[model samples]
Every structure is written in structure tokens, then in C-alpha cells.
Target chain A: MGAEREPERGAERVVVGDKRKLRLATASLAGCFGCHMSLLDIDERLFELVERVDFDRSPLTDIKHCGACDIGLIEGGICNAENVHVLREFRSHCKVLIAVGACAVNGGLPAQRNHLDLGQCLQEIYLTAPDIVGGKIPNDPELPLPLDKVHPIHEIVRIDYFIPGCPPSGDAIWKFLTDLLDGRTPRLGHPLLHFD
Target chain B: MTQPSILLDGLPVPFVDGQTIMDAAMAADIFIPHLCHHPEFKPQGSCKLCTVKANGRYVSACTLPARDGMEVENNSPDLNDKRRTLLQMLFVEGNHFCPSCEKSGNCMLQALAYELEMLSPHFDQFYPNRAVDASHPEVLLDFNRCILCELCVRASRDVDRKSVFSLSGRGIDKHLIVNAESGRLADTDFSWADKAAHVCPVGVILKKRSGFAVPIGKRRYDVEPIGMQVERLAARSADEES
Candidate 1:
């Protein structure tokens, strides 16, 4: 999809090449792939997205980091130190960064663990799980290091837009995406978001 | 025509079909655990403590609205275990110190915990580092005791339309927030009449100059366990909804 071309209602529209180039990439940080899946849940329209936007650096379309994209859609929370780096890069590289799910936006169910100490949980999970063992504990090297506290993206980096919910309803994501494609900042007009 | 008996823990107890489970328990003298429910004010079943496995599935006793065939087991080993775990989570999330708390002796949460035979929280502490805001001159903030049931926030938002209270953060970091610029509640437009003070189930939010005013022996929650009270209220409410 080109940055300058707009879609023509109901049907997905395509603006060829750099004529309307709207660079886009997606990254999944520290969350279940649920939010990413929701993006595709837009159904056949997502295939239309392929015709319109530059598909880069998404696990769905590409396997690289977004070097410099117009929009970076992030899914997950800023749990530890590595999350800070990812967020910073996205903020600097992408013209817009959207916190994509309950986890990324407000630190959802995983944040429930925030009630307890981090060391306590690591001990319980690694040492106390019936099947887990000292060496058997899986730790991803690429994973952002675990922090004592899990934080929402806004806590670490300024997010241009937030799409909250365990993964906001699919239609809501679509609405936001369309607005961004049309070249205007989209707002989540819900009162709850404004109460704070 | 019936101050009828409903089977509770195998014995026939007085059954008032329209009252809440908590209220029926109170009338029949049985106990059901609960919080965020009050007699003077309306019952807002946000706390989810009064949840019970009635007939097979989990249902909040206060909000479920009882039925005639409802076979309630207030002290069943299985149901009590769930209550224990839920109560433990509430304790860990914010802060609820029984000792040194104004609501300690008469608190609904404390009473339910005692009824469930809880000696102490088996889990680790969640000390969230929240501050106490005693700004209104009438109310106080005890960050440790909030369970985020959202009853107070709801009451303020829906009934009063005050927009003075809200819940910010989410999951475990979720805590009650005051509507102010600095995130300081005392700086807002809340007042004694807001009664946001009375809605808290734990000591997290307390009213100043109102503590212990009812005398130890006269306190309502201290006199009976919450489970029984929920049983009674559930029966009445079910009839209303149906």
C-alpha cells in the first residue's frame, strides 16, 4: 500500500509501489501470540492489506526487525531490560508505535504476577513446579531479561496510540488501522481510556 | 406460606426464596463469605468473594439470585478451598493488614478469611509500595487493603456520576485511583458524602472520624460471618430478577 493513497470503502484498495508507499512492520515482544493472531482475524481483508501496505519484519510476513518503518505494531509488555531496548528502537524507527494488547497497553494477566516478587515467582516456577528442574528451566536468550516488575509500554516509552484489551476486539484494530492508513492519528474514543 | 427449610451442609435451614444467599444464610444462621456488599447501601457484587459452586458451577452468591432447588453447601471442603485461594489472591494484590487496621475486627474480608480457617497467607508478599492518602479530611487511603473489586469505582462512576474514582493500572498492578492531576486522590473533588470511603471491603479506604463509631459489639460484620449473610440476600434478589 502506498502512503499517499486511500482505500475506497468496503473493498480493499491498492496504491502501487512507492507512489503511495506506507511502510509497516509488526513485532511481538513478551506476550502470547494472541494479539498478532487478532490482526489476521480481520479475515480476508488482511489479504487485502498485503496488496496495500509494505509488509516488512513481521513474523507473519518477514523475519527481520523493522529497520525503518512508517508504523510499528507491537504486541506484549515491557517486562524487563530487553523490552526497553525494543521499545526505544520502535519509537525511534517507526513514525508511530501502537501498544497492541492488554499486556502491551496495561500489562494484563501477566501483570497479575506483579502482585508478588519476581524472585519469588522465578523460584516457585523453576524450583517448585512438579516437572521442572534446575537445568530444565527454559530461558530464551532473545527474550527480554525478566524484570522485578512488568511494566506497560507507556511506563518505559511514549506510545503514540494504545489499543487496550486482552487484545482489543478485531473490529477496533481494523478501525484504527484504516484511520492510520488515511494519514490521521487515530484515537480510542472510549471514555474509560479518557478517565485516567 | 414458608419459613421453609433448604438443605445446607445436609441439614434443613430456613429458606427464603427471594433473599440473597448471604441474607438467607444470615436468617437461617449459616455463613457465606463476601465483601463489597452492604445493607445501608446497595449490594454491588464486584468483589467476587461470595462465589460458590452451587449445584455444580461457580456462581457469585450475592449476584446469582437464589432459586428454590438451590442446594447450597456453605462449608463443603471443595468450595471452601476455592474461597481460600481467591481470598489469598485478594490479600496478595494490594494490602490488607488485619492488625493495626481500623476495620480489622469488623471487616467483611477479615471475617470471611476467619470463617474459611485461614491462619495466614501461604504466598509471598506483594508490597506494592503504594501511599496512603488521607487528603479529604474525611477519608483515608490504605493502599495495602484494596482488592480492586471496582465496587467503589463503579458506584462513583455509575450511581454518583462523580467520576471522582477509577481503577488504573491492570492485572496485579491494578489499584483504585483518584481523579486528580498528580495521581494524588486527596487533591480531587471527593467529599465525605462521596461515600467512596464506605465502599471498600478492606482497610485500603477508610473514613476518618467514622472508625469504631458503632462500638465493637455493635459492628454488623463482626457479629456474623459473611457467607451466611450472602445466603440470605441471594434468595431475595433472585426473586426480584425473575
Candidate 2:
């Protein structure tokens, strides 16, 4: 895909090998991955997307860790230490970092726990539930420790752009990417900015 | 008699003598972003989202009366940046978790943030621990989502003639207080029929048992933005005039 000649600049159709496919990295921190699904909802446009960009560390490519990349699209809020580390890594590796979806931008649903004690919350879900036989809040060293409150990605690192929605609509994502690729600042307006 | 005019973003907007800049803009199908100014109620100018440059000076459009030949800038980059900062402050000052909120799709605050392209909350989340008042049998008051627009305060006092709601405290500590001696909605005579019950633009004053009935994607602001309806109304009036 990288070897393919870039799209002709204008009507002259000049071959430019200097323009390589932009590398993109994506990650799901504490979200449901609905934004990733929305990206896929671009449907046949995914073909066009692949022609213009390559995935580095993303669920699509199954790449474990991000290397140097031009763009990083992060979905979800920071709910644990692992999210903070992953976010920091993305910030260091990517030239442009985007907070995609409500979770990444504003802590969304997971932040409902911000009002309650984290330990009490775990107790209700694990130890105190009536249906549980021997349920316990996992204290395994492998598990990441939960933060006191859910935090949006911007609160932890610099986000160059944001795509707002529970999961931003396919059209909104498409417009944003195309605008960015075309070297235009993406602006979400009527019909594209629905919160649901 | 010809209606008076105000130059909003350089476009002439015709309005009655008593109408503010916001009212004139709405009358002309131009949306001036606002939260505290409702057409059916007196303008409060508290939220300040509708602030615009009038004659090169900033003024709340909701309260500033329109005058003939007055120039107002509503959509400039500088004004929008200011509005965005104010919105960010509102977001961090309250617990506005839109995904889990029953008012998620319908919330004016969420819709305004989306309309303004607010990239993020852009500040540390205060995560204020406010309590919910479920004492009223038919209404629920969740203090977490209040932006202090005071729509309910005005509605209860002016429209319902009940005076059941009022703003208390000051600055960051300020909040909505029930009028009853017990400081509970149940202690007050706030009912389903009260104007206050329907005035809140956020999830603060929700009618019990009617939540999620319209579904997530089908709510009022979900289908169209908060100001679109007013714009449509303006368009209809324009059509009538033409």
C-alpha cells in the first residue's frame, strides 16, 4: 500500500512517490470500542481509507504497541493506571492525537462513578451482590489499579482534536478524517454534532 | 409600522422594540447560542453563552435590547472561543456524564457543546458530589447536571406563581434550593403541572417514570440541535412575511 503512487495533485496527474501512506494508531482505553465500530461503519470507504493510511498499533491491525505514527485516535476515558500509560505512550509516539467519542473527550458513562467511593462501588459489584456465591474484587497484581475517578484523555495529555458523540457517527468520522487529510481543520456543525 | 432592526453579524434582523439581540436574531432565523434566555420567559443573561460584540463591546445578547442600526457580531472566532471556555468551565464545574444520563440526547448543555465543537471538557473535572432529590413523587432533582441557568427558578416564580425554587449560595458554592422550609421538593408544592417541572434544559428536573420513553436516538435534540427548532420557527415567520 505504501508503494502505490499518491493521487494526482490536480488535472496533470503527476506521480509523487514522496507522498507515502500516513501511519495511524488507535487504542481503546476504558471504552466499549464503539468508536472503532463506527470507524468500520465507514464501510466501503475503508478501502479508500487503507489506500491513504496504514494502521500501526490498532485493533484492526492487531499490532500490540505503537511505533512512530502520524496520527493516533484514542477512544475511551482513563479509568486505570494502564490507560494513563497507554495515553502517555500515544502522546510521545504520534504527531497528532485525537480524542474520539464521548468517553475519550469527557469521561462519558464510566465517570458516573466519580460521585461514589471506588471501593464501595467494587464492593457492590463483587462482594455484596446477592447472586454471587464466592465473588471477590480481584486484587491480582496483574490487574491495573483503578483510579479514584474516570478522566478524559485531554486531562492526561494534549489532544490535537476531538470527535464528540457517544460514538461519533460514521459520516462525522469520515468528514473529520478527509478534512484532516486534505489539510483542513475539521469543524463539526449541524446534523453531524448530535450527542447521542 | 415597520419593526426596528439590528445588524447581527452584519445581517439586518427585524424585531419589536422590546426584543433583545437574541430575540431579534431568533426572529430572523439566526441562532445566537444561549442557555438562560428562553422566548417564553424573561431574559436572565446569566449563562452568557449568547454574548456578542455590540458596537465593538461584549454584551449578553439575551439582555441587551436591540436598537436600530446597532452592529452585533455573534459568530466571530474570538466570541466563539470565549463561549467555548465558558462551556468548558460549566462542564468541569458539574458532573455531566452524557452517556449514562437519561437526558443525554435531549440535554441543551450537551447539544450546545456539540454545536460549539467543544473538543473536550478542557479543565479538571470537579466531580462535585451533589445529591438527588427524589422526594417528589413525580419529579426528580439531580443537582449534578445543573448549569444554574435558573429556568426553573423563573418558571416557578413567574409562570407558575409558586416561587418554589430559588438560587442559593454564591460563586462555586451556589446551587438551586427548594423553597420549602425542609429544603425538599416534597415539602414544596412543586407538581407535575408546575411550569418549573418543564423548564429545566438539563437532567436536573426530570419527570419520573417518563425517562428513556423517547429512546436515545429519538429525543428532541438528538434528531435536531437545540436551536434548529427556533431557526425553523424563524424561517416559517420569514416565509409568512414574504
Q: What's the distance in Å from true for residue A161, model 1?
A: 51
List ranges where model 1 is wrong by over 4 Å.
A1-196, B1-6, B11-20, B26-29, B39-46, B209-242
Give DockQ: model 2. 0.61
Model 2 lDDT per residue over B1-242, tens place:
67678888878888887888988888777888888777888888999999999999999998998889899999989998999999999988988877667776667777788777776788888988888899999888899888999888998999899999998999889998899988899998889877677767778988788667666666666677766767532111111212
Q: Which stretches of candidate 2 lie over 4 Å from their true place?
A: A1-17, A131-136, B1-4, B215-217, B231-242
Model 1, first chain, TM-score of: 0.79
Chain B structural similarity (TM-score) per candidate: 0.74, 0.92
Alpha-carbon RMSD to native, per candidate:
20.3, 5.1
The residue-by-residue lDDT of candidate 1 on B43-156, one tens digit each, is: 667677667666777777666656665676767788888888887677655545443467754565666665675433444445466767876676777776777766677667
Separate DockQ for every predicted complex = 0.03, 0.61
Clashing pairs in 2: none
